[model samples]
Target chain A: MPVIGGLHRTLKGKAALFILLLSVIGLGTLAAMFLRTQREMLAEFEAERMQIVEHFVVGTLKPVMLTGHADLMSGIMASLHSAPGVQSLAIVRTNGIEAFTDDATMKKVNDRLGENRFSRILKEPVQIVPAGDPMLKRAVESGKSDFVRRDVAGDGTVTSLMYPIANEEPCHACHGDDHKVRGVLVATFGLSASEAGTLQSMFWFSGIAFVLLLLTAALTYLFIVRIMAGRVSNIVDQVNRIVEEDRFDKRIVIDADDEVGQLAISFNHFISSVEIYRIEEGREKERLEQTVFERTRELREKNDFIESDLKLARRIQQNLMPEKFPTPPEADFHAAYLPCLHIGGDYYDVFEMPNRHVGVFMADASGHGSSAALLVSIVKAIVSTAGKDISSPSYVVQIINNTLAKLTPDDSFVTLFYGVINLANGKMSYSLAGHPPPMVYNRDSGELQYLQTNGSLVGVFDFDRFEDSEYIFQHGDRLLVFTDGLVEAMGEDGKMFGRERLAELFKDARYERPDAMTRHLLDSLASYTGGAALADDVTLLVVDYKKG
Target chain B: MKITMRVAGDVTILDMIGNMKSPADLEDFSGAVNAELDQNHLKLLLNFKDVGFVNSSGLGRLVLAAKKIGDKSGHLKVVNLAPDLDELFTFTRLKEKIGVFKAEDEALRSFQ
Candidate 1:
């Protein structure tokens, strides 16, 4: 899960990088140590070989010098010259001259032995040891062998040994025994190394280190990548599969008890929790759905019952209206009622009154629905009973108002225009109570007049007075009285059909029969409103007086 | 419709905006009136300058508000009625029960 330098690297990649880094550091350290150890061992081997050669030269030269085998000293020089690491060899006398170069001493020793073995003839060049050389002085004075090592140009190193031959009793047999030291043997050994050889060794060491590093890396890959990372990858694949398939029931397989195995176990525990949650969520969803379905069913049943009751109420309210208006030869009547709901607040009725008069009643109670229907029902009852006996329309309305004021609530009231028309004399007495003025159109003159009056709404104040306004009904005169809902019906544009439009429609339909005029007006209303549902109860009544 | 209430002297003025055509509008108008009356600030004046229309239901609610104020031994008045609503008040004879004034000061003075 760790990010390096804004890049997301997997666990295996980090492991491989870590192992490679360690291997590189280890390889470098091992190479340096191997190089240092190689150089040290070479130095030690060269020093040991130089010491052996020094001892060999001293031991071989002692017997030969004692036996007066001076020619054998040339053999010794030849042997030292033919040696592998030997550069040059010389025998220094007491006076720092080559011992064999003193021909007098050599002839004395050789004539005493009767041989030409001590011949003074020089076969090779002499190598002079530097006069002030520290090893030479030390070896000559102490009568011991000493060596000094120095780096020579281009040929590696040269080790020079000064071996002092002591003036012993045996060596004094030929020469005078006056001196403590006889001569020193100086030999230089070359520890030479070729560039090709160094390169070969270096190449071998590098190759071995490289092979060892490769082997370690291969094992690391096998263990980390193949075993550890492989299991982790398997766990990742399993998790991905579970997510893609949406199967929380499946789990990662546990292969070992290592870290990766523990990770798989943790993942499996998480999956189990998810699976349990999924099951519980499914059950909760089912329970919620079932509860909602049951509640909806119960609500629907209640709504259906209420709808049925409302339909029954509508039928009863419709029955309360005059199904057939009084068909007198003196006048013709037509009415249309459209409720905003199943029942309406607007009511109208046409029936015969006393003295050859026709009674016309239309009322709109305030507010709507069942409350308005109840108020309207009370008005209908009052009118059919008390109105039948009262000769004055104003007196009848006063009675209705007093009765309603006692029965209805303080906030509730009704607007009604009631009229009693004398079919015999064309005298119509009407009272407008908190209602919109109805239009009276003269079909003969084509003149329109609104029957306006100032009267308060019914049932609000029992002390309020009602007055009668009279309009003479003549031949070819039509009256259209309606509730406010007729004028206040809204169109799609939020404008009402309005009193102006209603009056215009009344004038236009002056020539039509009462029934046809009402239908035409309602059709125009439906058209103006785009046949949308009404927001209020609309009640329209048309009375045409066609006198014979 | 939204009703904004302000106090002018002893009278609580309710500024009725928008046409009181919907049932919600009726409730808002009645609620504002009832709330003022409940607080015993009963000398109320309804400012009807912005009211465009009032259907019968809205008229009923207004009547209910007036009756409520009247029953509380307080006065309710209206001012700045639109032309049509003034005519409505005239014919319906609501002007007889509640005072209709052309200006706020006239209605507020009538409260005394």
Candidate 2:
């Protein structure tokens, strides 16, 4: 959401527009009243001008009847001039031409018009412009003053009064008949005189109205801006501060029934509830972590106990292997045994044959641990009782496989390189079951040949067949037997010493004592792989086929 | 150190009364419940109404009881909490797993 910046004002509904509409309505009503008042005042001013015309014509004619002198025209002009709002006057006698008059310009206008001025200005009264005695025509006919509204001298709009004369007792002497109109007198007044008074009144009214309107606006603004908006904005500012500072713990304290007061109360309540929840959450989290810590400690102690017990059990289990192997009476025997770590399932043993042809066995479990060690122990026990029957290494493996097939888990199996050396003949036959082949170095040809016959690891299938390969050895022949671990030693740089490296190491090697050579070869391998952990068990067996 | 224990029907109601301030007592309480659960899987109600405060270690025992019951497929509910402990439950989202109620009847009826 976009933030509102200037003021923290939140007007929820339609209040602002409502106030604006009210102000315009108030001003419009006031203006209507002022215009109506001005129109009525103008109407009254026009009526007063008509009354002045009636009085001027009636008074002048009454006096002219008594004196019959030209002084009546000057007297009427002077009295009308002294009347308020009056500006000019012109009067003429009963002749067809200019008669007695008081306006100084009348003499000039009389010379200009001659006889036509009186008849033209008073006869029918031009409907368009100012003329003499529209009242004169009325007085001649109905004997009363008449009124007409016009503009004087083609300038501004105004009202004109025409008073006509038709009677005289003294007119019997040389003045002509009393029924013939004597003269017409004209009065001119500026309409702006009345307009000025009205304008002055409007000015006073407008001044007072403006002051009151301004005062009302100022009062409304004060109450709304200072009193109302002020209090509300104060609350809003506090709320804004709370939000900015993340001070949800603080609360607005209010004790009133109004909306803002209620809002303050509700806000306080919400803050308190959330604060309490936060504190509780802190406690709960601490508790859960403590529980986990305690559990970790328990598991550690339990693992330590279980590990020590396994060590003790491994020592007892190792004691069960055959303590000594008998030398074959008519054949030379050589053997090597290696276990990878603390314990493993690699075992080699020589048992005295009932027929005096010894059994030599070398067996490696598929993978080693306590379970495989237990299996090897079982194999040892079964083979100890089958001493006479285990003359051939292949027959021993076959019996072990059948016994272990039921004891092992599905898919578990072992491999063995087992053989029997017959002292009566110069030939020896060996069986290989999924184990690396033994190498025979023929002293005659000075070449090492590997005897490899593929077969499945035992304990997987009882129907699996073992392959036996034979070789006849001459004098000074050397046979080398080893587990796969011999070539798999890791070098100082973490590279494995593979079969090629081992074969290369054995090249052109000659030693007077086969035992010394065996010791020398194993020692050299150890030196080459210093500080590199062995990946598998290192096993070696060397036998010299001496001439009998 | 407060220990409040209630047995209603086959369900055991154990209220961690007062401030569970003593770690030894709390551990013992969790241990005892676990041994009892080992013998007979008793439904549990761990109430916190009178518990004023639980430091980190003391609260740990409650979690122990919860996990013990959870592992054995038995029910453990916490109920009738004072405000502060109630705060702890809500904060940890413990309210989601353990049925939290205001009173004993409410706690037991939750099983139904």
Candidate 3:
């Protein structure tokens, strides 16, 4: 079976069922009560009719029987029997013998008595017993004055009444007064035709009333369902459309001030909120996207400007390095430079000093980028002007340091190694200002030594000092100077290509020419670092003393 | 690089770690030192035990710190220098300008 609760699933169905049920109970009860009243009214009318007939018959017979006029009594009974709806009228003795009867009652007694002697004296006093009707017998035995009963026959209903004549003063003269009941008057009235017709009409009226009531109930149910279900269905349809189309702007159009209208109002409020939220969210997203686009454009423009400027600065820094070294006839100089950034802090220059000597200079400013590049330019200006004024390498360094210490910011300084090669005497003098010691490799002996100098960092303290160290150049000896970037180059495992490794490489590459030696050192560094990006600027300068 | 400062007697010990080679690193160090000086914490001990490297800019910052402290009529010292940094101090002759100590207690006692 399908679910039983679906009977009133729709509003129309529920309304119809409710109206039908209420009407059925109300009309059925009304009909039942009306029918019962009709039945009782008919019964009461029949009883009243029988009682009137009995009184009429008894009133007429009592006077006749008191006057001892049996013939008058018989004529009166015949007239009463001919009255409308009267089936039988008779007077019978207490022993159930008929005393007086109408012609119809006499005929019935004769037919029942069949050749009996009692049937011959129909006109005179006669003893005719209505034995077939036990009600009459019971009335006689009970000695009651009036009794009534009813029986249904094929043709009609019969109401029977038994009225007893009591023994009075006049009756005692005729009958010697031995019993209380002298005789009984019996009257039978037919009620079937009238009652049947009335009941049939009542039934037709009830049926018509019931049909009209049901029709009224059905129409009322339809009207209510149309008003309620129609409005509700409209709201549902609008809501479904809004949901299916994702249209928060739509609203229900119920105009009443009832519950459904209030519901529509609430739904519209919700939809309005949702629409506002959607609009706000869309605007917010657009605003965020616009902001991001603007920010990205600004960043891109700034980056482009910075990149162009850095490239220009890099070119200038590159120009500061010497492209060609002087031919000193005794030594060949070569240098390799790599900057971690677009601009580097490492700078090197080889210029001719007085007395036919060449000044080999390498300096590494702190940090990188434009600031360091600027610092290196200042150093270059100071060194170029001061180097000519000061013949000693240590004095040139001191002058540069004192100038930078006053000019540069406290958080920036330079480490430098400056050396002068006296080409005529084959002697080298150098000063180290807080820079890594330059290494000298003897190609013939395959031994590497560091040119240690007692000096402080430049551009840090005004009173700081620097000292010069001297080394005699020998044939087949190579001098290598580099910034800390060379020794501090880190591998993938975080180990530095330390000074020890550089010394080993310098000793091993002693047979290489100055240019080839610098190239070999860079290659080894690249191999050691596994081609990772350099974290600092690497600058290497190799000077090979070809002859002493 | 992280720089943390703590007080020992009258000395402010600034413990520095990580490489101090970049301009940004030096700026932070200088700013911290200046903040300490502004707070009248003149007696300072720069502890470089965990510091791995100090570039030219970092050395310059140390020198500047010493000079700033001296201008304020106070003393600045250094302690717990890493091997490389200790070598750098000797090469730069920074010990002559600023007292160099091998331990924090020694530096703190010097401040006392």
Against the true structure, whose lDDT is highest? 1
- Highest DockQ against the true fold, candidate: 1
Q: Please provide, for model 3 over A1-548, each residue's C-alpha lDDT reduced to its tens digit, 9 standing for 90 to 100.
A: 11222332444576576777777777777777777676667667777777777666666666776775556656777787798668877777666667644354445444544633223344544556546557666676687755546556422346666777677876554455566776677667766666667665767687668767776877776777667666766676787779789998887786799988988888898888989999999999999999999999999999998897788768768878987989778888899998885466899998887877888999988866787887788888877888764357888888788888888777578889988888887787888887888888888877778888568778877767688888898887888899988888888888788888899888887777778878898999999999998888999998888887
| Cα lDDT tens digits for candidate 2, B1-53 | 55556678788777665555454666657665776697775688876766665
When sorted by DockQ, best at the front, the candidate numbers are 1, 3, 2
Candidate 2 lDDT, A1-548, residue by residue in tens: 12432332333224455555666667667666666666557557656765755575567556764464445445665676676555555554422234442343234444554532322222332222233434454545565556566643312346655455654656444344546666555555545545655665775578568757855885577456545555566666667777788787887757467877877777778778877888899899999999999999999998777577557546644565457666554445555555555455666676666544556666655444566567667767766776356335667667777887778753345557766665456466677765556777766677877776545456655455655666676666776666656664667875556556665555545443555666666777778889455545566666566654
Better of 1 and 3 by lDDT: 1
Docking class of 1: medium
Off by over 4 Å in 3: A1-240, A243-246, A254-260, B21-31
Off by over 4 Å in 2: A1-252, A255-263, A279-283, A290-294, A305-313, A320-343, A350-358, A387-390, A423-426, A485-497, A508-536, B1-112
List model 1 lDDT by residue over B1-112, tens digit each: 9889899888888998998878788888878887887799989999999998898777877887888888889898999998789888988999999999999887888878
Cα deviation of A169, candidate 3, in Å: 62
lDDT of 3 at A104: 47
DockQ per candidate = 0.56, 0.01, 0.45
The runs of at least 3 residues in candidate 1 whose Cα sits more than 4 Å from the true structure, single-residue gaps closed, are A1-227, A240-262, A474-476, A546-548, B17-23, B49-53
How high is the lDDT of residue A405 in model 1? 87
Q: Give candidate 1's TM-score.
A: 0.66
**Candidate 2 chain A: worst 10 consecutive residues by lDDT?**
A118-127
